[model samples]
Target: MEMQKMSNGSHHEYETLDKGIQPEEESFLPEKTDTGKKIQFNDFEGKTSFGMSAFNLSNAIMGSGILGLSYAMSNTGIVLFLILLTAIALLSSYSVHLLLRSAGVVGIRAYEQLGLRAFGQPGKILAGVIITLHNIGAMSSYLFIVKYELPLVIQAFLGQTSSSGDWFMNGNYLIVIVSVTTILPLALMKHLGYLGYTSGFSLTCMVFFLSSVIYKRFNIPCPLEAFGNFSNNATIPEDTCTAKFFTINQETAYTIPILAFAFVCHPEVLPIYTELYNPTKRRMQGIANVSILGMFVMYLLTAIFGYLTFYANTEAELLHTYSKVDPLDTLILCVRVAVLVAVTLTVPVVLFPIRRALLQLLFPEKAFSWIRHVAIAVCLLFCVNLLVILVPNIRDIFGIIGATTAPCLIFILPGLFYIRIVPIEQEPMSSRPKIQAACFTSMGFLFMTMSLTFIGMDWMSGEKRSGGGH
Candidate 1:
């Protein structure tokens, strides 16, 4: 069998394996060969079960983005948001198909390596930088959730107020504690597959949160007497509870970008594919579909219930909107705790790809080392904690990063990689696949341009609006 070169430092091993050796279920086993020499076969990469892989990918796909979705629904109204969201979800799955097809053609698992194969060194660098930036933003956003929400959770449990000077109530201190105690150890794991259990738990927590949102819709009366610090004397219009089927306004531009960013699990997709047991393009694509479909249901339910609960008054962060109706409510407190736990567990899953991308960029030829792995995890967590602690209300920064990188990951890079790496001889320029890939790439450019333009308008017009976090 002819072997394609791998750019992520596994070339030698794969090349050697190509010389008539096949990997199996065991980690390593020596095989008797015709040449009277034992051949060592390693199955280091394919240990993650199908179910666990789906859990991890599902955890990656669902993030703090879920919290912002209700706000997106509020802006676009019921009919429009559903249409846009379903479109984005389908497009996201198609994007994964493009990526898997590209990876299959080149026999490369790493996204950066696929880039290198597609466009050489520059391609590799672009993939590496985007992965780094996008994951960092994700990690920071997750930690920001911990920083802001964890304290509220603790406060609620302890029956204390935010004004309390206790260390647990301090978001900065609580975030560091969670990072060091919970996040650090899991992040130190050698492989992405090992985090699968935690990812499963994280998904469960989010499910609890979604269930709570659905339940609360029936319990909490609309046209709330008081919203946060707003006066109870303020009268909300009676129509505030009415759902809008279709709407258009300045805020309408944010709906697509919000939904686009919500579906960004591209960085995690290739890594999970590499670790899947009995890995195949079809198998990985199935995992992606299952995960995406699961999240689609969760996202749709969360948005519909959350929007129905608040109607026009839904805040960008769904949890915060809940606080407006008695922050000390036991059910709401549990929901907050669930969200905190979910986001905390997801950080390590997001961090793995960033570290892998870094290792690929900085030490492509070097073998994996414990020292390097632990160090990368530590550094990433520390930097993210700093961003959460030191950077006050810097979500706009991450918002911009998400706007730029999310679409690239979701649409542009996959489409471009497919267009460039899939040989013209196999699929000619005028072929349907190539034409579709070209169109996919164009759509990404359009998404990025529109997202940035709206965001720029917000900044230029001095409107510090809250839509959703990417």
Candidate 2:
């Protein structure tokens, strides 16, 4: 029996495989019966349900990025931000459709395999690299949340003041403790399917976070009495509760990339699809739709309520804004804990794609080993913890990763893969699919160019502010 490697480095053997099967007819099939009836593949045996798959994907899509949406809304205003967000959601859903269609047509379940089929080794390597970087950035963001919020949660629980220099209260120490005790164990799991439970819990935490934001929106007063206590010397805006309907400035461009970063679950999509029971293009697409739509509603509500709550004073990270208002408030403390738990749980989900990408690139021939898995998980968490401790600005990290790899994964690669994988004869020159692919590719380029330009502008403006202060 000949063996072929699956995306996760496991071998699958097929008896009497057909070598002459065309790409279009290579759909996944179960073993043939004595009468030659094609039976459906039940490899999973219905272990994973549709709800679990949707929850996993939803957890992947909603991460630390949700915390920044209010800040993005503040930059672009209510009208423009909602419009931009809706457009991005629709575009992201379409891109996923393109990717799944290409994979289904070729019967390739992994993103790297699709890349390998499209452009040989270079394509595979490119996909792996992008996945690694994007997911690393995501993991770092989750750890960043831990770094900043964990300390506050601990202090709230202990009723300790911020002025205390207790070593136990140090953010870095707390992060290390949490990583070793909680995140490391979760990250060491062998299969992505096992994470469905944790993913569901993680998503629940985010939902609580959304609910808390909405509740606080009505509870908090304008010109925030909380901010007065935190910043005694700073001037407070008189009309902080009123939302901005429309606005554009140097900072507005940064919001586009931030929003782009929020919708990136492309790397995790195929892995979930492969493990799905009775996986088909239509079924997987349904999973994608449910996941994206759920996240879209959550993101919108979070952004709108967050922005409305603090309006002019909305900080890049919503938790920070809440901290300044009343760190000791019971509801605020609960929300902080929820956000912290949510991000902690999310770190493992994000790490799966990164580990898989590394295996694909560096250890393609190697079988899945627990030793290697634990070591990689440990090493990655260690490095991300260091980055979280050292990197003071989350926005800068978001900008750089969102500007570069996010676009490539979300837009460019998918469109290019579809164009290359679908036969020219099947999608003729004037075909709508071909035309849409071209338009999608063009949009990816435009997003990449704009993201870079805005990042540069943000950097320059920061330099100017530093120079002026000096």
Worst 10 residues of 2 by lDDT: 461-470
Q: Candidate 1, residues 37-130: lDDT per residue as tens digits?
A: 4332122547899999999999999978799888888888899988998898999999999998887665667889888988999999999999
lDDT per residue (tens digit) for residues 247-327 in model 2: 797668767777876788999998888777766677888999999999989999999999999887788778778878775
Model 1 poorest ten-residue lDDT run:
22-31
Q: What's the TM-score of every candidate structure?
A: 0.91, 0.87
Kindly state the number of residue pairs that clash in model 1.
0
lDDT leader? 1
Q: Which stretches of candidate 2 lie above 4 Å from their native place?
A: 1-46, 226-240, 390-398, 463-470
**Residue 265 lDDT in candidate 1:** 92
- For each candidate, the alpha-carbon lDDT, in order, equals 0.84, 0.78
Enumerate residue pairs that collide in model 1. Answer: none
